[model samples]
Target: MTKEKFKSLMQEAGIKSKKELAELMGLHYGTINNWGNTQGYPTYLNNYFHFIIKAKKYDEALKKGFDESEKPQECPSNVEALSLENARLREECEKYEALKRALKEALR
Candidate 1:
């Protein structure tokens, strides 16, 4: 990948900048530029990319959990309220998966 495209991927992963990527990858800042411009970049980052993708998935799931928790609802009975909450949580999980797919497509 071109340096710009690599940088863009990092940005889409919420990396923000080369320095941030370096920090996350535990590499020297200069190494990011080298990888960005070189053929070996993908090879070097292959395992790391897997982790990054997993992390993104985890983040989406966490956000969904939080969104579900934030919603306010009322039910006539405690059991009914618990059931409603469970359904909302399930819907949020699905939404999170959808959001991740959309993000992946947009980055591509």
Candidate 2:
């Protein structure tokens, strides 16, 4: 990725500076600086940043609970279907959290 796009992604992911990102990724600050000055970031960085952003959204969603306005109107008429959908959503959330943890461990 280009340095500018990398910086934008970092900002979107709530990473304030290149040094902070370096710390999170277990890399030297100069290594990150070099990417901006000379070599560009690896292509995988795009996916990594996107994952971080999505993970942050997941965290917020879990904390606030699902938005009622986002729920389907017809769910109220079908209690069984609603229960089944809730269970499936919970399972999917668990899987996402597990994958996020695994990725963090691997990065370290």
Among all candidates shown, the one with the greatest TM-score:
2
Model 1 C-alpha lDDT versus the unseen true structure:
0.73
- Which candidate leads the pack in lDDT? 2
1-108 per-residue lDDT for model 1 (tens digits):
556666656765777777887888788888776674553476656556557878998999888755744654422356697889999999999999999999999999
lDDT of each: 0.73, 0.87
Off by over 4 Å in 2: 66-108
Q: Can you give the TM-score per candidate against the true fold?
A: 0.50, 0.59
Candidate 2 has a TM-score of 0.59
lDDT: worst 10-residue window of model 1: 68-77
Clashing pairs in 1: none
